[model samples]
Target: MTPQMRHRLVHAGWLAAALAALGGVFVLYVHPDFLVTLVDQVWSCF
Candidate 1:
């Protein structure tokens, strides 16, 4: 592959990863149990 094509592929990979992370966060936010479990875990660290 060309250097320019490789650069574009890398950029697309990062964008995809970011989108997936955001989607996962959104799904977790929509689930109350996940929030409660997350809070409990954090609180335990204190």
Candidate 2:
């Protein structure tokens, strides 16, 4: 493959990862209870 194509593929992969992360954040914002539960579970380990 050409260098340009490889570069584009890498960029697209990064974009997809960023979008997925943003979506996860949006879900947490939409349902704060989920985040609270997650934090609670983590704190319980202490």
Instruction: State the lDDT of candidate 1 residue by residue for 1-46, as single tens digits.
Output: 9999999999999999999999999998899798899899999999
Q: Score candidate 1 by lDDT.
A: 0.96
Cα-based RMSD of the predictions, in order? 1.5, 0.5
Instruction: Find the 10 residues in a row with the least total lDDT in model 2.
Output: 26-35
Q: Mind giving the per-residue lDDT tens digits that candidate 2 earns over 1-46?
A: 9999999999999999999999999999999999999999999999
- The candidate scoring highest on lDDT is 2
Whole-model Cα lDDT per candidate? Answer: 0.96, 0.99
Off by over 4 Å in 1: 38-46
CA-RMSD of model 1: 1.5
